[model samples]
Target chain A: MSSQPRRRRLEVEQIGDVTVVNFVDRKILDEQNIQIIGDQLFSLVDNDGLRKLLLNFGNVEYLSSAALGKLITLNKKLQAVGGRLVLCNIDPQIYEVFEITRLDKFFNIQKEEQAALQAF
Target chain B: MPLTVADTMNYPRDVQPAVAANVTISSDPAEARRIQEEIERHLQARHVSEHDIFSIKLALEEALVNAIKHGNQMDRTKKVYISYQIFADRFDVQITDDGSGFDPNEVPDPTAFENLERPCGRGLMLMRHYMTEVVFNQRGNGVLMSKVFRRNDNGKK
Candidate 1:
């Protein structure tokens, strides 16, 4: 990694055993931003040893395919640890992106965070 | 002779509207954001629908990344050329990179059961779905894509 200090890209909150994460950036479009976000997300699994994750996308208005790639990797990481990851509050347009890629089938997506929290 | 409204609508608007722009940048993906901002400002000025804006924005992000990262291999010395034109009926953009192009057909279907876990190759699928038209040059290093304007939609597209 570069010498630059890692800026906080995620707002984390704990509810019982589940960790809820919200992105600090509205547009997860840039590669560097997505990379940092991916590293931070991985730390939740490797470093923190969190089992279940609830990702709230209410604050995220835009994200690129690279971001989706990161999510897929995160999913794999969670599965390797026998953990789970759920996504909620995705915008309709963003939902369409997942649908187009047929990733909606791969990830556990809920319409609302309340519903998502229940999934975990 | 004067043209009627119906005729005006019928005639294919091959010409670029008054608002058109082109820019070239190093293979740096971050620099692509400046071009995205320019397109967003122009689309908002024309009162393009929100759905349409979202489509263009996402597709552009995918295309720019493909050009900078995959096409140019993140080589900052190379250049990526971007240009856009908005007609009454649609918005069009063309991105060309300096690297040798690869055949888009060789790209595997990310939706296929075996490929679902793959992280990359979904960008092309998003570009094809979001834009009304997406065409690549023979060399595959350049791409031309467009989105037709829409007033309202029930999510059919």
Candidate 2:
């Protein structure tokens, strides 16, 4: 049986007590890529036992609805474990999406990496 | 069955002045990226603004994903039909899939306070938010969306 190819779409870095996850580049995160990203984040929480996470959207120009859904899922997952998820450096276009959906209220969105880390 | 403007046009010369294309893709999620790239090239050729391109791209991806994943249920045997057109001031996209259709009205509002944490209907919300118009067929197996460009101070379309 052929196995599914394992690909890492997010870069994880440790800063103090928080894990900063940076998107690779300014590309659209579609359904398939969102699934890959969700799995990686879930593993970081479940396997690596990370408590706080900061998602850096500096290079992410666009986000599909599926990608936003994945972020919600990650937020709930982390919250259930008493952990927190902070998002930072969101592109204005992408930020408008969060505003339209009212997700901006539900997430801890910051303007910069320093602010996001400080929030944690 | 794929829906096309040519299906209803009786005269060749009556066709609208727009760039349009149609394709049938398998139920693979990866195909969405390729479709997005191809559409981006077409939009770029027409001098669409980057902001408008990003909005159109988001709505396009959501519609395509809904058709392939929800409408077709990721059945490899089933195919998703996508058609798009770029006019001078607007971009139009249509996506259809072969599956048991459901009413789009039944989708709950994701922005509601009680449903804030839920992720089920955000795609449709985002599509409606970004697109100038979003219309679903009565059967709910197909969706048509359009994004109209706003003129800048220079009166560019």
Candidate 3:
């Protein structure tokens, strides 16, 4: 580890009817990040009005298959309540993962947040 | 005659010098996932960060898939060797198969124009991005990758 600070900042926050999950730098979402995201989802499970999830991976370089599995799991959880999950500002490499798995057909992916929000 | 890493096959073999550690698996695709898990666990035991473990796992999986799909041509009778090397700050892994060597450079560039829609090239690309270094040893029969864990060791998990 270098003395410099890490450029990546991963956070999951609830904003109005949507949960904004931002991932920065490198993909793989790591196990720590996955647990955090799971925690966030669990905390918001009771919010019936929480109908949308916006995953912003613009800063992410690539997502490991493990991270993709986590995302798929989260997507399924969100779908159970009539809520939807949408991807925003995804990098090409990460997008490639979705494409390879044919997950793009299953995921609502958008290039911008407003577009993702509009799908709701 | 001294047995280089290539001499032994069809059974589990330990790689020499333990620069890190190694494991061998049958060419069965079913064994791929298990061998990968074992490799990841071994690295975690050595205190490698979770992030680096993911990188190693991804790179190693890609190599193993190549070993099966391209190298051994999916022949269950053959074998594959997966080796690991752990240093003070980095880990190097290599996956070799029993089949004859091939040209690494001949591999199509995943980022190139026509190859955009192809599935195979992307694995090599992902391996390159996730690892600090990737090489094809002189034998041209395997892939070698090293990853330097970039974790901040502030005693923080």
Per-prediction TM-score:
0.92, 0.89, 0.54
For candidate 1, write residues A1-120 as lDDT tens digits: 846689999999999889999999999988989999999999999999999999999999998899999999999999999999999999988998999998899999999999998997
Which parts of model 1 have CA positions greater than 4 angstroms off?
A: B1-16, B153-157
- A best-first ranking of the candidates according to their lDDT comes to 1, 2, 3
The weakest ten consecutive residues by lDDT in model 3 chain A span A1-10
What TM-score would you give candidate 1 relative to the actual structure? 0.92
The better candidate by TM-score, 2 or 3, is 2
Candidate 2 local lDDT, A35-64, one digit each (tens): 777888888999999989999999898787
TM-score of chain A of each: 0.97, 0.93, 0.73
iRMS values for every prediction: 0.9, 1.3, 8.3
TM-score of chain B of each: 0.86, 0.86, 0.77
Candidate 2 off by > 4 Å: B1-15, B153-157
Docking class of 2: medium
Which candidate would rank higher by lDDT, 2 or 3? Answer: 2
Tell me the tens digit of each residue's lDDT in model 2 across B15-133: 47468888889988778778989999988888888878888888888888888888899898898888887777777778888877779899999999888767778989989988888
